[model samples]
Target: MPETALLPDSAAPAAGPEALDDTHYRQSFGALCEDQVVSATNAIYAENGTKLIEKGSRIDRELYARLVQHKLRDPIDQQIGIEGMVNHESLEAMAAALLDQATVPRLLAASLGRPAALLQPLRELPLPGPIALKLTLMRDRCPALLQHALATLLVAMFLADRANMPTPLRSHLAAAALLRDIGMLHMDPAWLAADRRLNAQERRHLHAHPITSVLLIRQQGGYAPEVAAAVFEHHERLDGSGYPRGLRAERISPMGRILLLAELVAALGHKFGEASPHRLGLVLRLNHRALPGALIAQLLPALQGDVLASKVQVEEASQRFAGVANAFEQWTELQQDMKPGEVRGEAFAWLNSRLAGLRQSLTEAGGPPEQPSFLLAHAAGDDLHVADALALGREALWQLGSICGHALQRWPALADAERDHAAGDAAVARWCAWTGAMLAGLPGSSVD
Candidate 1:
């Protein structure tokens, strides 16, 4: 069992009448939605001080419908703060509470399976007051969003720290992480809640969300270009398979890569109830070619080993295969000096031999590798980058090898930080330095 933290006192629900501040109220107002409770930052009334809706009232579906039908007679913005807007003072308190120990999830604590040290650097990281207020208000409308935002913030901050991202860039990353999925609020609730696989059209609509989310953030203004660009590319993949913009790894900003990885990890946890670091790492592996491997590699060290012995083994094995594939890619690049036909043939031969050995190893280990082998066999080489072809092939093989006999485990959420924690922020200033150090540290292989 791991130690856990409790939610802070300030997280307590606000009851009773309150008025939204007059100027801020209008600037941040939006339409009321079903099941969202909103309040006035300042008292609001109709033409003659007749209160139309009390402050701090929970707007149920029916009330929302009625409010919509009549447009609330008086201007909706003047009458009620539909966004549950919070002021700067409240925002600071709310941000503080997110770091409280009571807020740590138990399962996450168990997964960490070690002493819970405060991430002091993360605690000290600067967050804009307005960003916090905006995100908190957004969370009021979509309750689950806050969890995702917090999770993304945690992971992104950790990555930013590890990569030595700039301080300004780190702030933008945090903002982007919090607001990247804001467009989901505008989608149909039914669609958002559906558990089944989306049809093609539905996926296309969902794919458009990155664009919409960026637009919404821009409308709010005061955000840096880094923030807007990251939000726009958060869903994109390294291999151009991702949506709205099919951007390649080099094309995606560094913050965008971190945001993408963080978002995926957070989503996995939300869907299955627990996303252990190891599992999340495997997700990175399985999607290795499509994602930024360097960024994923940076996060691999943080995952707890052997949470389930076989799962960890599989992840390790997958990582090994990815390495071999990487070697093959580098080898192919060197072969650019050779005849194109010979290079292609040599690449195919190398891949086939590795896949054969991987299959045999999985069989001996009692893991299944047949399906991924077939997929690899079917993949068209002409369309892939030389490196991507090998990377994706290895991933498919590793996926089959890992899933052969074991069920993918979903750990229960026993504990988690209620709010973000403090961790070192120096990475924000030294990402390039770290990158240079890392590349220099890698052992070079002979091209021959």
Candidate 2:
């Protein structure tokens, strides 16, 4: 538990001060661009480090068991992202293969102006990356996966700035909060995997990550000294339970609060039993918006994956020219585009025929006839195959202004591999950025 506050100033900024408009939004953007922080995944990885393991291989179960010692077990991280931390809903769905939620399709969506990037990952740029800059991650545990987790953590901070806050305050908070754990990547894997937990000697070393992040930024020679200051102050919490320095709320920067919230959320969100990832996400999303907790929380279970089968059914249908099974398959085999709008015309005709049949069937039964609401079940020798109908259905859903992932829930098991990824690694860094753009329906933007 954190130390109690002795002195108190209960006043805070008004919850609804007239928001800065779009024009003012530019002012905020302009201010951010001026800040000289090599702020991208590549930059972060170079500044810190990540663990790298061979591709397509599972982590050593023995190593993981040993690493998750008694003290460490305090943090139960289910549904983590590529990095160890939990984040705003589990994004494994966005990045996972099951829904084509990764970078490429999202970029395509951005180019098409399909949706808003709000609540998406790449809320900001100048974030860290996946490639090795100054160090390699392979020497540690799941380096690539862990880096993604860190990126997810950073993404959480970026979104947290959404609450009515000042531009400078938000930026300060983002930078400091993101790099708070930079030093952890350097500790020996054996130490990280230690079973007995950290002694006082180990705790001292653990406190150094924030400092390591500060020094790295300064050494890189760009960010404002003020920014660096916040990084150092992050461990200094409001209640005085923090390490390195026990500064209270007044002394702690907003960045400190943000990072503190993130750390707490991350720590608590990783637990097993009652504090589930889905439950954690709902609570965090609500709390962060309402009060902005001292600790951040982005739960994994509440993460809604690629829209849904029904929505995908519509999208595929909308994209396809035919009415059913393998209709698009032949198209894929051919390199050239079909003659003009032939596919669209054909698909529409098939739809009309089906609609007409439905209307007639309803009239025959002396009932009101509207559109046919059919589930995707295959019937042998059918005029339209289930696959074709499914595709057409997706298009129809899109026409109705409902994107694929409208009704989503959390998945608790997806992010187990997240911690193994490295923070500041290049590959996962770019992926984070790309994934953000896709989700938000924006373009010409990068997360890092």
Candidate 3:
């Protein structure tokens, strides 16, 4: 929709077979084979020309040990076949089914002229052999991921069509959305568990998933470079807050922006269920700096009249905002004593700028930092107003926590600065502790 050209593929060249970490994938595939009918279509061989599995051999847990130990002559996805894998036909059916039931998909379909024509792009997409095999495995193993991918595809196409993009570009956007998460197939299943709190190293591994997916798509061939570029930027935010690479502004491609917004919409639907549309409105309002405004303007028509019917307690919201105010107050006090040239001062300055933005967003959303309780009390009886206010407050708190996490990640020196200035370090620790405790009380709030 933005019409920005695709960024050059400055990412390193696609990884060869030897560089891939396929152990986790092989283990997942093996487990899937034990449950589903999966087998080798050709003889699997190691790099040394030793035959591992004969052609047409049923692959299962027994073959997993053998497969994981070798550096294969070719990628395993190229040689394996899964029964009833997701092909173009099945994918079309899946999209049609989702349109019939899901609110967002239906809205997207109706937004695009002919409701039935929404599936045409997906129907025409080229699913190469290896990509199809990987998708089938994802369907059998990580069904949630597959579901998210399908939802993202519908949203991307809807956005592309609304922007008057060409048919070929629309096809490329659809492909990028659908294949963006395939890299997760190669990641350890444990790393994705909902309750698992990842350390910095684990988080870094998770963040590189976009790069992993780009490599996989490039190596598999048949896709245009635009597809890989869009996938690489799917997790990136326009404000440079996104991971793997902190790209900002027009540095992100037009297709990448469409894909990123689509990904967020799909994820919100999963995270908030019936209230996704409502929560999405608030997220967009607070994050106008991070997401494209024009695309959001187009999306607003669908969100209208989809307000949540649930009630939010005034006291609960009041407390949340009070916590937000207190956190900012502590930071202000700490900032007073900070020197501008030092590392900790620079870190605090960065945090201050982000927090200032958050404060302004909250005020604009009817919950000013200095007078949150007053605003909540005034809107106490109006359901829509209260919901909007509470949603804004919740999102602001979540983002505040996220800012702290990013600071810690971006400035490893923040921890070291503690050694030089114990008092300042203590104050920063106190602020982080307060924010964490406050966020724990919210239903879906987490630091990053």
Listed in order, each prediction's TM-score against the native is: 0.52, 0.35, 0.90
Q: Between prediction 1 and prediction 2, which has the larger lDDT?
A: 1
lDDT of 1 by residue, 137-190 (tens): 556655566666666666676677668787666766877776787666555545
Candidate 2 positional error at 322, Å: 67
Candidate 3, 1-448: lDDT as tens digits: 3212333345544456655687788788778878988788899999999998899998788876678677888877788888888899898888888887776777667666576656788877779888998888888888888888999998888788778889988888889999999889878888887778766667777887888887788778888888988998998988888866889977888988999988998787667667777877888878888888889888878766456667877766676677777777877876676666545556555666788888887777775687768677777788877777677777777788787677667655444534554444545655665676767775545532
Candidate 2 regions off by >4 Å? 1-124, 127-155, 166-174, 194-196, 273-448
Lowest lDDT 10-residue stretch of candidate 3: 1-10
What lDDT does each candidate get? Answer: 0.48, 0.35, 0.77
| Clashes per model (N, Cα, C within 3 A) | 42, 66, 0
Q: How displaced is residue 98 in candidate 1, in Å?
A: 8.5
Stretches > 4 Å off in candidate 3: 1-14, 46-52, 337-343, 412-429, 441-444
Model 1 poorest 10 in a row by lDDT = 405-414
Output the TM-score of candidate 3.
Answer: 0.90
Instruction: Record all residue pairs in model 3 with backbone atoms less than 3 Å apart, i.e. clashing.
Output: none
Clashes of 1: 42
How well is each residue in 6-106 modelled by candidate 2, as lDDT tens digits?
Answer: 11213111112121112222222223223322122221111123332222223233333432332331111210113322232333332232112323222
Model 1 root mean square deviation, Cα atoms: 18.0
